[model samples]
Target: MPSEESEVVVVGAGQAGVAMSEHLGAHGIPHVVLERHRIAERWRSERWDSLVANGPAWHDRFPGLEFPDTAPDAFASKEEVADYFVAYAEKIDAPIRCGVEVTSVRRHTHRPGFRVETSDGTIDARFVVAATGPFQRPVIPPVVPDGAVPVQIHSSGYRNPEQLPEGAVLVVGAGSSGVQIADELCRSGRRVFLSVGPHDRPPREYRGRDFCWWLGVLGLWDLETPPQGAEHVTIAVSGARGGHTVDFRALAADGIELVGMTRSYEDGVLRFAPDLAANIALGDGKYLALLRAADAYVERNGLAFPEEPEAHVLGPDPDCVTDPRLELDLAAAGVTSIVWATGFATDYSWLEVDAFGENGRPDQRRGVSREPGVYFLGLPWLSRRGSSFIWGVWHDARYVADHITIQRGYLAHGTTDRPGLTPASGNN
Candidate 1:
């Protein structure tokens, strides 16, 4: 196959890829964005039909565009989010080619650049930016016994309640997605059994403001530290009713049976760990710590915000852990569906180069990979917590675009450390 050349080649046409392409465009830098499917394919198809943004639309803006006429506090639907990216790409004239899957990206041995192998052809680009967002593959645990359930679906495959089986549903992993799915199932008059996990549950509204608003004000998005250990606690939130709280307690109150952590599924039976109380306490502790940290930031910064009122109905009592039936017979319980809302995995197998660390993730400092001319974006804590969000990648995208432009001259002419090679300056 013939090879096409560009100044920069970005993989994945999601929010991060679009942002990177936009910045490169703005800077008069030549680049092309390659997508495996249509633009924003994940948002277009992976999410449930009734899904909406966990955060308000106003805060989800890219650098040069905002969801026009969207209320500051209103949440956007998945389709709208997907459409926004399409419109943004058109607005910025992003050089994006859809249905082009990148097979591999490796450094050019004979040149100061990279050779990107794609389904369409090969791309000989001076720089390559991997904007494939953090969640590349859905992670359903192997403990889920095969053929134990009649129907098994990952949360990404779930669409709406009407699409599910007629009986009860078992939702594993009680993070934001799990809770939201359970809530929808309960509201749809389906019995929902939610397996609880240690996840953060910030109240939807706190001290007369949205929790996300407080997070923004308190600079939680600016947090640079990644979650320690294998258990990375994701934000447990919901975009239902514009924006609301979705937690295990709320799900339980909504008639969804709260169960302990899932252990194993064998012989038509599902088993749960007996650590229900401990899990609830762990989640509540994290929630309380978040509130305290926000308050501390306000006090230290001397920022004037509404004073937090006396504790109200924040969450369910931690000790109110119900010792429900730990072992559930799949057939006897009439549980016809299982939705695995169990997080995702970062797959860099297509990169075709050794760039990961002991953690099996790219060993990069803020998107600047160790491999010359190779970069990464749209990763959690790539620079800050926001790096994985829609509004956040602009920072890292701008930085990477700048880096690419700075090294463009050197890559083209085999020059090194030559002074006064300023990047193509445009909007910052």
Candidate 2:
């Protein structure tokens, strides 16, 4: 309200949004980043007490900075990462309006600006960057029966393993989130049980170098099969879901018991289907698809690949999914804790746009929306494999910011032809 016109309005001051904030600052762009909570508050508040980032500290840092060598290979705890982000904000002086919740964004029919509404008030801006990460919405399956227990929580809500109930804890979803939590629990002398589902494979070192380097080379973050669509079916890479990660191996090392995928849960009991590998198969297929895609891309781009991968392609968790049935007596086990790291859902209700196809995602290329001046960043594989992750944000941010800068420069210099200047996105 104070200024009827502004340069840009960015939503969500997390990793993605914050990266944009830094780039905008470097160019002296007068923009505001609207965040519901303090910068990186989610990392500080939501992660498990003992949880460290799965990736090492070297690759996990945000743009414009690096973690001290003292930081562990696993990176510091969630709290440390949060603190680093907070410190980053201060150094960059990103214009962040913390505690301001964004409600909606609608276009101004008369101009290039968008009318953005927030908890405090509304503003109009010429451009918008949705740095909001894709996992804003948590995916909770609806297979649970009524009154299963009083303490059901998603991985997002879990801050410490001590919060879970005592006895044999049954963790659902064998993805990285679930597996990591299970590893933590078992390592801490807790008898943990994990409901094995479809999962990703593990890699030794990606290519001839570290695994992170390989992810960059393969364009994992850059590759995305629309969550749904023809792209979902045809372009969907098998390796998308289950790329190399520490899952079953970690479980084996930690001595955690793996359970079959639960088909249904009722009356404090979880039931498994006859086919056990059903879930595991899905996970494997996605991972394989991704690996194949990466291989094809390397071949297509004429990029040389290293010799064969040293790691073996893991098949399934110890508990085979081919069996007919099994059950988990949560009540009897006195199991208290459950971590659902299965995956995420996109809740874009606040974004009113017709561009979103049936898949509920705005059809765009490289964050350039079908709608003018509306851009997206930090989406998983938005341009390439690392696009949304810490190591990748800077690359994407520079492209978008440079494009914006060029556009501004062009307009100022009185260019006769007005081309839609977008950031140059090279998946290098």
Candidate 3:
């Protein structure tokens, strides 16, 4: 088939796909967005009620919809963010084909068209955008001590305190989700033990500036304006999670017991790493320094303090405590539940496409891949800073949408496959 007879297909209508679809609609580009599930279903299904966006209500919002107005420093609940996404989908109509699960994509060497086979039907498209963001997969390390006393559950499967096991529960991993789950479990009066690992942290506010303000000034959240020669570095910096990035310190102040990293969960006791505190401190200090720098920048810029930043330091505390311990040995620690707030993994198995690399991740530079017109958006390190942020996908999508438009224009002028639209691997 010729490219002129095809449409553009976008896969995965999560945050990334939604942004791509909105841009395509804005550009009058004819594209259909295929989502395996309804919009915002992941957040609703995978997160608990107390789970909130890691960033403040402002930065957490996706394009086209503002979070429901709440306290200035409040965290937007998962439901609120989900509702916002739902509204965003409707606002754009976005040409979304709900329940369409794409099975495979094969590029044509004869033309710049892809035979995209989906559950609904096969549609040939001149281009395909794999906007499936990260967190599509969950990683559960099987380091649990054999015959451990707790019920193990991945973060994705946890919904409420009741779902957690009895006694002092161990919440591993200190990412946003980890700490949040710890706080929730503790609030529900469960004796909770937290295993803090290396994760980013940032203050909600710094030096009288809203968290986003410093991000804008230091060019953190200024994702639209890409800096020169800083592609990889910028992504790395943006992805850094600081203590200020989360409220673990506050949770600690609230009396949540913190422990060193679990070296191994054998003998019923989660053996502590001798340098676990050092590891936690290193990860924590980097983020703290970032928060301080943002605050310093606010002062240097001479901007009127927008909000009074809280600069109080947490009091020195014990390095580790084995409290909430059930058994004197490991089994009696009474800790029966283990919630792995570790994180998610990316799954691309359903993509029967021929455009993946050896790592199974779509082999793409930013959005453009060697696989002809196959593109992927909202991937970390895809391009420039925050390529996966709510504000970042526009740049990547525009680049891809422009490419598709060029292909369409060529096809409009009676050009079939000038130079023969060969796949990267030269398959038809």
Candidate 4:
């Protein structure tokens, strides 16, 4: 096999990988970006046709890159978002090799670096950055029993209502993906049954402004908390609803049946946790907690922000859980399809190192892995709440670039280290 070499190797050509390459380029470092598919392939292949960005384009700009001036505030469609990523890569002239899938990554024993094997060939690098993204693998519940219904697709495979068969659809896991898809299905004249789970329900527009903007203003985006904790649960917000809270009660009122967390799928009958009402109440409570925190901050700072109307709540239904209808029969309910929006699992199986801990995660300070010369990027809460988003990835990306430069003894060139870009061996 042909061999290649670079000072740094970045896997994936999505926004995160692009950002890492940009930073490396700015530092005059020789690096190559490898992508298994086209740039921003998820946006092009995985998302629904009608899906738009959860926030305005302004919230999605990367470091040293901004959304087109023409569509600054508009919600970018999936295609538009993909185009933006491609354009950014081209505009920066990033050294990206598309259609190159990295098959394995392992320590280079002969030297201080990594040996990366890819579909195209092999490459050795002094440093390897895994920019494969937070959503690497679709997570279907293990309890979803054998011999499931005829049509079962992860949200990653779902495109639009036309693709689904006639009759009701059971959307498992009501996170952002589940709620959004369920809402769309319901609106498109399909009877939708949504299985509720532990999720956060934040209003799209808390006051007159978007929820993201409020988070940015409150310095929540700058939060550098670690990833593991009790409060760690998959977030549930609606992008299709213009970043609005996906009110379960409202969804229930819209003729969408809301069931508790999925328990089992045996013999064509699906069991639920029988805690639908309680789970919804907890989510609503979290929303209120967020609202109260923001309110307190505004009052303490004496900011002159105008008040919006009181929040609209679709109060709970006590009978939802008590009813024996929590058990769903796939054939009898007329459910023809099941869309699992059950979140993603981070799989580093291809990495030929014991970098993972007992928790199945790499031991790293920020993006710097314990195994020197390896780094992680585009992970949620890696450095901040925005660490996984396009706008926030710069924080971790810059840090990784600086660390690589320092390891290469080029930090003195003043090329990689800016005031805040110094390599952080500790949590900020």
Candidate 5:
């Protein structure tokens, strides 16, 4: 294999990698971005056909680069989002190598930096950025036994209602993806059952502003972590059908059956947790909390935003919450397909560094790792709540780039006074 060298090697040419390259180039840093496929490959391929970005175009993009002719509040479709990234890479002249996959990264045995092994060749660099964002791996829980459903697919594999087998469908997971898919399937005339779970239900638009806009103005996007006891809760909001508030009551009223969290499947029977009512209550509490915060902010600032009474209304509990079905016979229910929208997992097995904690996640402050030249990007809560968002990735990339520049400067000046490069820390 051929060998090359650069000051930095960025693994993954998605938003984080591209942003990193842009900021690094601006700092006169020599680096190369390696991607397994085309830029924004996940956005182009992994997402379902009808998917749109969760945030509005104006807020979801990198600074100064608008989605072409897109409405400020409109959520860009998956293709449009991917194309925007491709265009951004081109405009920045990013040194990205498509089709090059990083197989492994480890400390160089005979050098001070690191060695990155790739499908194409080897690259020795002083710093390595694991810009592989989250969603590296799809997590389909083993709740269903083998051959339990005639057809099964993760949310990533889902394309459209037409791609599914003709019958009732069960979407197991009530996150944004699960709810959106369930709604789509139901509207397409297929009987749909949504396996509800712990989630935060926020109105898509509130008080004449998008929920994302409210988060931004309220500084909630910068929250370092989830509120107590709500760490594992997913947000159940949607950009589908021109964006609307996600109300389980409304979904149930519209003919989509709602059920409790799935527990297991065996002998053609599926079991569910009896926490449907509790889960709905949890989400409602979060929603009300958000509304109260917004209302308080408005009162404090004396902003004359019209009061939304509907935002405070929680419609009657659907049957799923009032008297939930704890079990179902798959065959009797005629469910032929199952879509697992249970979320994603990270794969850092290729990284041969002691940067991960006991939880198997990178232990880093911001993007800086204890492992000297290694850094992580595009993980949720890396620096803030929005760290994994498109615009958030750019901010994080700039921070990482600035940190790298400072480290290089220290080395050039023969100084180890910086906190990350202190002599006792072993880099010296």
Candidate 6:
């Protein structure tokens, strides 16, 4: 338990390591952070006690904090967004530490930068950052085999609907945690289903705004990706009841049962993927291309915002996408729990950094990496498209704290020709 030194270490006290320790203590640098559990520990113990905060509470917070008493368009709860990131890490006195854990990082064999190892021990950092945020490890898609569901789990181990198991649940993954845990297990009377993949439904409000204010007045949350054919979709909007419009034909007129896209569970049957009416016409064509791009950005900025017309309806098509049941059987349809809202992978296998890529992710750009001091806070689009939200991880942690204050002014001038520290652009 010795080694500890830090010109920055970070690794994850959530809300991207307390927004990278409040922009590395507003650039005076010297960081620490750590956290293997506490401070928004996955919104206080991995979500689902009727979670909330799919935005709203004034654009999902952190422009130096708010959401205390909440209500800027509400939606906060998930224990008020984990007590507003533990009151924005105690209003930015953020050095953090919280139980510590990291486990490995690599690079500094003898010296120039990161070592990190942790569960409370070796630190040695010239810079590390990780900010472990993309909801680490929960994917669950073995396609439901092991004991096939007497009560499977993951929706980060769900929580409410009286903790399942009275019969008929299923869920699987329609994103936004499987249509809000199959609309809270079909409003708790159970018998749900869900599944339906390729998501993106939008509208939790339209002309009277808040589809994240038309994705921030239609710049579309600074889009870094996911528009062109919605690359593997998934954002099925819903801040739960008070916030609405996930629809699936109004959750199949409130009876739930959606299905499609599970594709394999074998003998006790399951199958699925007849693409439930092409996943409800690909979420009604990305919810009519985000209401015709918010009606052409309110007619090219003439903006007075009024038209709702029930946000372009689309209704109808439901008996599991008009008789599209490809298969199910689980004890002749009395299922008995499953959940799996299938999403969340990002362990970084304790990050031994060749800066990752071949899709093991972290091939950074905006949170700079290609190795030099190795940053990377939060994930999702990583630079734009609300980089993992919470005011886009405080503007990508103040652009990795101004690129770690220009790589600590070229490592205090012994310069290795760092220039603007390259790695080119964003969204890697």
lDDT of 6 by residue, 153-259 (tens): 88888889888768888888887878888887788788887888787778788878778887876677887875677655678887876788777887878898787
Residues 1-428 of candidate 2 have per-residue lDDT tens digits of 44354687889888877788888888887788999988877787766666665566766787467765434344456677777777788888888889998889887764456788888887877778887877777877887743576566788887666777665676777755677677667876888777765445434234444455556656454565434432311111111112335545346546676667667877778886544456555555665565565567667888777645433366445533334338877778777666676567677788775557677786677777777667788876677656767768777887788777776665445334556532222000
lDDT of 1 by residue, 193-279 (tens): 888877777777766677777778877778888668523776678878677755566566768887888998788888998877777
Q: Please give the RMSD to the true structure for each candidate, in Å.
A: 3.9, 6.7, 5.5, 5.3, 3.2, 17.5
**Which prediction has the highest lDDT against the true structure?**
5
Quote model 3's TM-score.
Answer: 0.82
User: With candidate 6 superimposed using the best TM-score fit, by how many Å does residue 327's alpha carbon deviate from the native?
Assistant: 23
**Where's the lowest-lDDT run of ten residues in candidate 4?**
419-428
Report how far off residue 211 is in candidate 3 (Å). 1.9
| Tens-digit per-residue lDDT, 1-428, candidate 3 | 21222367888877788888877787787788888888867878877766666565556666566776645455666777677777888888887877878887776544657778777777777678888887788877877854576578888888889876567788877766777678778878987778776555555556655555566678765454344543322110111122143544456667676776666655555665554456456556755677677657767878676544345454454534323222223456678888887776677775555667887777777688877667888877577566776666766777777776676665566334556444322134
| Residue pairs in candidate 1 whose N, alpha carbon or C atoms collide under 3 angstroms | none
lDDT (C-alpha, whole model) for all candidates: 0.81, 0.66, 0.67, 0.80, 0.89, 0.80
Query: What does candidate 4's lDDT look like per residue over 1-428, in tens digits?
Result: 78877778899898889989888998988889999999999999988888888777877777566677426656777888898899899988999999999999998654456788999888877778999988889988777665576688899999999998898999988777888899999999998988887777877777566778878887877888843552356667755644566677778778888898888877889988877877787788878877877788778989787775467444646455446256888899898899999878787887887577789887887798888888999998887888888788866899999888787774234535575432222111
Q: For candidate 6, give the lDDT of residue 13.
A: 84
* Candidate 5 segments whose C-alpha is farther than 4 A from its true place: 415-428
Q: Give lDDT: candidate 1, residue 173.
A: 81
